[model samples]
Target: MTREESDMIDHRRLGRELDLFVSDPLAGAGLPIWLPAGAAARHAVEEYVRDLERRAGYQHVYSPPLGKRELFALSGHLGYFADDMFPPLRLSADDEFVLRPALCPHQLVYRARGRSYRELPLRIAELGGMYRAERSGVLGGLSRVRAISLNDAHNFCALDQVGEEVREILRLIREAHAALGVRPAGFRLSLRGPGEKYVGDDAQWARAEELLRAALDGVDFTEAPGEAAFYGPKIDIQIVDAAGRESTLSTVQLDFDKPERFDLSYTDASGARRRPVMVHRSLVGSMERLFAYLIEVHQGAFPPWYAPVQLVLLPVDAGQAGAAAELARRAVAAGLRAEVDAGGSLGARIRDAAHRRVPYVGVVGAREAADGSVSLRLRDGRSVAPMPVADALGLVGAVVAARSTDLLPAAA
Candidate 1:
């Protein structure tokens, strides 16, 4: 490789140079390609979030990428999010198809079909690709993208159950963030400005807005009015990056108007039909944006559970190559993402693992080879002390399972 390339290829720069993903103009900008590495990162996050949501009592669902103009008309997306959506494609030269800007509308229809009041609260989650038309010039890295894979969910519940559902969702959001080791920097109660583009009755809007505000009453939040989606008020969860730039990383929005528009209802215990409240949420927002944030935050040193490669075994000599291969096999058997790096100096290989932010680097040199021991070096260069190969593998397995954000805590 050229010296210029080496000098320029730091983590973030290499992330682009290696084609992990790209946001380019020819692709109409703000669109990212999920290259192999990027795809792995995307998959890992999806699996993680899906598992968390499933445990949180959410039922997974998938919907079509494009919804009919009439479907969106019912949800008021045509009136509210028309600017953020792509131009409708003529499906039959008469009818128009709008690339769905959000998943709530379709999910609402799913809820309306033959749902009994017994299903007091239904939480539907989706990890689907959705599109929006961001102007070409505003597109930067993966942080802001046109096409997005969202970890979005919607909760349909009885009016009286709104408060508890909101609290449960917040708990799940906090738990998910903790699991991912992403501590949010700021929280905001996103409300509609008076007489702004906001629709719906003022009293209902106030009640819905108050529900979320009350849920976050004891908690701190930056009050951001006019940022709420036109359909309802919301909570825009923000995170600050290493560069100190703040971005909305997640959201939990409260909706009271759209359900009425769609006439979504459930029979109350008193045998009277009543409208259900809707809650819109996205813990990580889009996979594209989340990946970009993670790359920058960790500087590509992804946690063991999220790292594309968790372990790399380096052989001391050609004779130990077989042992290295065996170690790799064992790692795979243990359900780890591991590989054998047989090139360059032991130090250079270690450096390579460090560069990739691999959680564990295993070294099988002469003494360790004879004793079936392996020297371990963390991405931070701290030695794990040559231990029995089996014990080293166990340690690697534990770290990978824990999904710790930092391999080791910061020194005091």
Candidate 2:
């Protein structure tokens, strides 16, 4: 790649310029502190995904970041994933705890309570924090972090409902990625074979694999033997970023062992107790990694809905500052993120906004302020004709409401 192209896709540099996040040596590696701008963007993403999950009939929940040692032990995490977990904290001889490395165990606990056949295919979701003990050498920007915020969920369903549940999960995955303008290059049908590390008997594993395969019929995916999780088979969504780097961004796994391990069951319509199958899935995977991917893919220029500051009103002189501030207030009231840039000269302020990759910039001078209009400037080097304040607001409001990726819809 050319130097310019290489620099454009460098998330670390762009993150600094955009004031997104920061990592400190004293604070330890792989732990990034999100600045105000970064936090705003993160909030936007979280809200968007939660809305999607809600529409998909998933009930959201908040789980603690730490769990008792016995919880992980019961979930088989200690046996299969202990290497990536932080050391347990011993509060007392009998009360040892460890930071949660995944959300599955806590979710399993939630499902262990009494449930009925009417609640079959119960979907529970959480955008909660998880901790991992990563090697210092592998720590890099947000892509690889010790503290991760996962968009995780689990579906508890009857055996006869597994196929439909998987299909619905896959649909949600596709819709979410499409909304964010991310295209999955392919899928990996991860399975287990000849591995003593896996849980469940051979017949059980074989049945689960067969169910997953049948669910994935008509979908294009590559079979990957031995890539399955210790307890289940999964479909991993592979993403290719603008820099041509490949990463797995989403996953859906079918698990039969965890429910039995936790002794979870629900009463069937026939009045018989039965073990419910569990499906562990992450629609967007790690928020940190997804944010990093977005930064690189869009080159720090986020869409209107996701941009921290959707529009910046630049007052040409101190006399017009009131007008700019009032405009910003109106924009915010209309459900758009807007800011007034009254610092430095007009040229400097414009350049600063451009450098920060703000989607829209409005230059308000005395004449335009008196006329109740704005000279709108888009990120691309194109300027719209001076338009009435109401019209400009309507245009931007439409874009924000639609969550359109197109910055210059007028031009388009």
Candidate 3:
């Protein structure tokens, strides 16, 4: 589609029409509020990512969004990364607490205590909040937000285990992209460029770059000097927007600087203390940017699994209201998102459902209701013959469970 065509279906328009999110001036620029529908979808994605990390052996933790100014100083944010950070909130002359711009500092503190080789690969993950002081002119919808809820993680591993840990993170990124229907524009090896202010020395940078290169063995990527994080190099997964603009959607970075700065150490096999490497990675980036891309690419018809309302039951008249309500209750009991809309005419309700981008709409007439069945109407304009309510719900559940991109099960 042309850029104009894509722009017309941008997330800003779809978000308004679908009630996904809203940005009000009183709430300040760049801080968008998630409405109910958007909140439900975001919650689903958050649950999926947390579970994915847990199954991958990551221990989740909660961290505050504010920290002492000294914390960022230790993380090198004050030195090389102050432009994007908000001004420090001075509680007193010596007790300033600033909103965090990154989670690495907090993660490093988590590993501050003594550790052994057995915990070499301590994978810590969080779906937490951070704030960036983005310029007002750059703030638009959910794409560029001041407050970001990030899906961030940090892995502290021994030097020998860095290669495998980075590669495994790449695997997780690919799986998440497939499940979320994210089409990567390209992959990038972000590195330090000439005259750029960076934390590590030449030897450390070279070693980090080499490790990242080795990890991208079978993958196609381009070198993007000057795009790497202040501390080290990263593998950035890029996504194109409705305007054909490309931005990072996920990433895996190699960091040797943080461990040294934080003095993180682990006991080696020979009873010697050793420094561990910190690997920073985000499987799906931030929720705001993710939804921005998802809204535009899918045109608000999100995949069934993450769609706000999976099924809407429309009863033909008052007689079948009971039947529609019963099916909706059953769908909820089955851990599916469902609702009954009996306020409008059959045709009107169907059109409304289509406008809302509902995945499945079950139309209940007298005969179908009497049989405890429903004629399923899909969002793609396909209609199924009247089937048992249980069977209809099963089809949806199957697609959701498989995280299939298709609205229907593969066999169907």
User: How close is every model to the real structure, measured as TM-score?
Assistant: 0.91, 0.96, 0.98
> How many clashes show up in model 3?
0
- Between candidates 2 and 3, the one scoring higher on TM-score is 3
Query: Model 1, 354-382: lDDT tens per residue?
Result: 76777888888778778888888888767
Error of 1 at 187 (Å): 1.2
Quick one: best lDDT, which candidate? 3
Candidate 3, residue 348: Cα displacement in angstroms equals: 0.8
What TM-score does structure 2 among the candidates reach?
0.96
RMSD of each: 3.9, 1.7, 1.0
- Return the clash pairs for model 1, or none: none
Shift in Å, residue 112, candidate 2? 6.0
Off by over 4 Å in 1: 1-14, 17-19, 23-28, 408-412
lDDT digits (tens) for residues 136-235 of candidate 3: 8998899999999999999989989999999999999999989999999999999998775888899999999999999999999999989999899999
RMSD of 3: 1.0
Best by TM-score: 3
On TM-score, who's better, 1 or 3? Answer: 3
